[model samples]
Target: MIPFRFLHAADLHLDSRFAGLAHLPAAVRSYLRESTFAALGRLICLAIKENVDFVVISGDIYDVSDASLQGQLRFQEALKELGEQGIPVFLIHGNHDPLDGPRLVAEMPEHVTVFGGDAPGYATAHRRRDGQEVAIVSGISYPTAKVTANTAVTFSRKPGSELFHIALLHGNVDGDLQHETYSPCSRKDLIGQGFDYWALGHIHKRSILYEKPYIVYPGNIQGRSVKETGPKGCYVVDVRENGEAALQFHELDIVRWQVTELSIDGMEHEAQWVEAVERRIEDIREADPHLMTVVRFRLTGRGNVHRLLAEKGAAADLLSELQRREALRAERKEYPGLVWTEGFAVESGLAVDRSRLLQEDSFLGEMLRLAEKGEGEGSREELEDIISSAIAPLMENRELRRLLSQVSEEEKLDWLRGAAELGITLLSGLEGAGEAEGGFRDKPDGGRYDED
Candidate 1:
């Protein structure tokens, strides 16, 4: 066995649109458009700096099924850079960029090996100094966008090979419900294959499923949306003389996604609210320092600030102020120091005593009692029925149906809770019904994007 090193990355998602972010400023939107490309460049630079023997990308080199010309060109250019450095790249196409889909004509460099879809293809990495065989890479690409068959089972190790074996696959393992269950397979299906490492893709969040043989998912090179948060990057695996592999993660994302909750419990004045949010933003900047962070802030806890936030245009005004401040900060810095505000979810509530209100015999008391009844009885079915009825019209509208289709059951339940809270706030006379803004209201199937 020969000692070697390689970089493992998956889910490049090149030329991502960063959709549903048109509400941001032109400067931020323009930066986001190039972030995916920047992340890819960073990955290639990392591979060169690490001086890895080879690079393996499990799947999803492009964002769409029909790979875009721009994405293919950018990917080709990056691969050429690696090829110039004498580093070989073995890549496979996942569900996002299947082989059967249309792609622009961009010839790959000699050092790049794109695995075929018919069966698992094999590529061997050799030492540049003496041409000694080091590692064997086996991978398969998706024949079409929908790969229902267990693609992992198609791979079989070369019998009695002394070189380290690495399998690159893109599929759901053990039925992870978070992503589309394409090419589904179990852990038992992957283990005991004589492979030294399993390089996987498709699920964006990184995880190490096993240790002895090193089953790893390096995740996407960039965070495409707020749902995919934290540091996004690839792994550099070092194969020692003893045939044992060691893995190290290196972040390559240019723009990071962050979700945070800020309590407005003690704040009585609007200035305090602004200062508190500013402090949180500063904390996030201090942590990331180099990368631009897109934050989804949730305002929680009971306070007088909720009363103010419930007023028309109050939250929007605050958001604008924050955006302006960050934009100015970015203008001053030579590098990316900006923390773009994606929007705020005001989950804060009034300071009224719900228990005290429940004891009264007024219309507001009856409403509170009914809310308690619904909550205590676990009226999930009833809430679902109400939500479905309210959203039925929105579903009928072809324009909004696509957006509403992503609403999860958890989100629907959250909306029901928000509706109950808003009803109580209105009935309690904390804010005038006429003054209550649509942005503050709990909209069925459209809660997260009520803000601009």
Candidate 2:
């Protein structure tokens, strides 16, 4: 029986432009630009530190359309770093970087083994620590960019020995709408293959499908967009001869992109709002001491500043205040670390639980009732779509296709509550109009009067 360790990482998506983030502070932008390389460096460093038997990168080494030569060269350097440690790198071309890949000018290292061809390819490597054969890894590179067939169908048929059989695949196991469903397969398709472990890529969020055979998706090495908020990194898997493998995740992102929501409830003045936001920046700096941070603030809950926030230039003023705070930090030589406030939104309403209005029998109550329709299972998803598409054009960030994913999580997608308050604002603007709900609205999210 042989025991070994390996690093499973995927969806490098290197040389990404990281578009839609230009408005962030220059320092944050610069850190983000270099964050991918830093993350990859961390992965290599970990492999070297753990003396892993081998490293497997499932797919999407670089973006085919936007990949740069510099990105390729840097990638080569990282692989070379791993190669120097006698760490065999097993990689496959994902949809982003197909077999007939872009950025072909860069040279790959000799120690790196890329599984090519449409058919699943098998490669075997011995443990660097011992001479014994460690594991047989199987992988298939996407020949072309637009592969629609089930790539896993080939995995079931791929040949491998009894020793820890690991399969590297870059495809959607199920019908996940978030990403392009290339090389589609099923969880049953993977677990049923009897492979000792499956390192999956293509999806950006980390997930573990099953444990018996050890199927995993390490997610992207770096968080490239706001939708990719939270800690982003790779996983280290340790396998024993005849036991369940132990897995640990390590954070490798150089910067953290977080959306911090502040409640202005009980606050009285504009100065209080600035002071509160400043405190949040300080808190983030304390928590993520070394890493740069880009934050998008959302004001929620009952507040005196609701109308102030809704003003045309209110968001701009808040942005300036944050920038001024950063400048003061630099002047006073305080945490000089980079913590930036990119943008913000106002979701707060009158100092009242608007749901109570829904139960009323008046015009405003009727509006609340109609707005609450989307909260139910019958109309929630429909309403979500309508709001997302309607305001999709007004959004400053164009990377995300939907509003909900960009703004908040599923459980907290209660922006509908704020919609009720906004309806009141619109209704007030309508000069006592009995009813409202028509005409074009250019504001982000939705129209105020269109609600109540």
Candidate 3:
């Protein structure tokens, strides 16, 4: 076998609207809306720059099954450029863009080969230099959006082919819980097949499930949400003549998503909060000076700032001020890149001395003890029941019911933490009011009214 190389990418998710982020500024929103397309452009540029023999997109060419005309036109134009460069592209349709879905009126370039859903399709890639056949590409597309059957069993390596074989698939491996269990198949099922490389999709986090005959998922080219953070990109696989393949990852995302934390442990005033947050934003911009960043700030730890944050609209004011500052900088072109604040979360508590309170045999102590107990492993089931009961009415709404079903246990625990902190702060405030009025004193159980 001769040495060859190819670009392996998946989950382009073009035309992603970046849902759940509708509150962003018009300029930032527009940038996010076109981020996926910009990622596609970067991918095309990388392919041409590397001068690879071919390109393999495992699945999910569009964000939705019924892809938009604009997305299709842009995609076709990019592929046409690849065709002009004499580079072939082999791709498959995942659940997001299945074969049965509606599509644009335009046709794909001749150099592109889209695998069908009837069976595992096959193609041969020829090196443009000498026109020598290098490798065999095989894949299958989803017939519809919801595929419940195990599609991996249907694939078999070609008979008597000495060429390097790459298999493309878009399905859950062994029922990966992170993603929907569509076209479920086990890693054993894939490994048993004699294919040289497995170009996978569906799950949008990159992973190399196996090596030797490499099984890989290049993740999505662009992150559509904050949950999918960090650098998003593709892989360039260089196959040595001896069949040992080397992989190089490249970042293609234009706009980045991040969740940053700011500790208010020693903070004494509101101005300090503003300065600290601004510093964190500057650090993010400096780290990636070229890319635009959308960050969610989380303020943590017990401090005086926590009491300020407890005030109605305090957190909102802080977030607004930060946003206004950044917007002004952007307008004046003060910074080389933009760092937009997505939202702020004040997960802090009142700066009370917990040790003294915990020692007292009063209502405040009991409350603190119970809050600690709630964080233990044994309390999870009870906490779940309590939280579910509290939110039962909200869950009764059809949309909210469906949305709540998708909320993870970890996120629910965060809500519990925030609630506990708020309860503590409110109780502490009442204690302060009682002392200042000289109307009450701490009793064994709780506060008591003083005798005249």
Tell me the whole-model lDDT of each prediction, alpha carbons only. 0.81, 0.73, 0.80
Q: Which ten residues in a row have the lowest lDDT in candidate 1?
A: 443-452
Clashes of 1: 0
Candidate 3: C-alpha RMSD after superposition: 10.0
For model 2, what is the error of residue 150's alpha carbon versus the real structure, in angstroms, after optimal superposition?
Answer: 1.3
Best of the two (2, 3) by lDDT: 3
Model 2 has an lDDT value of: 0.73
User: Across residues 1-452, which tens digit of lDDT does each residue of candidate 1 receive?
Assistant: 77989999999888886655556666676677788899999998998898898999999988888877888888888988988888889999999899988987656778899999999988888865566789889999998998999988888887777789999999998776578889999888889666789999998999999987788889998887767889999999999999888899999998898779888887788889889888898898888888899887878777777777777557778778888887776566523657877777777776778788889899878766765654556777766676777789889888578656667767776776667677776778765432433332221123332110
Q: Rank the models by lDDT, top first.
A: 1, 3, 2
Clashing residue pairs in all predictions, respectively, total: 0, 1, 0
- Residues 1-452 of candidate 3: C-alpha lDDT, one tens digit per residue: 89998999999988875654445556556677888899999999999999899999988898888998988888998898899999999999999999889997656778899999989988999887888999999999999998888888888888888999999999988665668888889889898888899999998888898896798989999877656778899999999899889999999998787778788888888888878888898899899888888787767777776666666456667678778877776566543468887666656665777787777788877766766666787898867776787799999799788768877788787777766666666676543311111111122123221110
- Which regions of candidate 2 fall more than 4 Å away from where they truly are? 21-27, 105-107, 157-160, 324-336, 352-359, 366-452
Per residue, candidate 2 scores C-alpha lDDT tens digits across 202-276 of 988899988888889988888775556788888889888784699999888876767778887976677788788
lDDT of 1: 0.81
Q: Given candidate 2, what's the lDDT at residue 397?
A: 65
Q: How close is each model in CA RMSD to the real structure?
A: 6.4, 7.2, 10.0
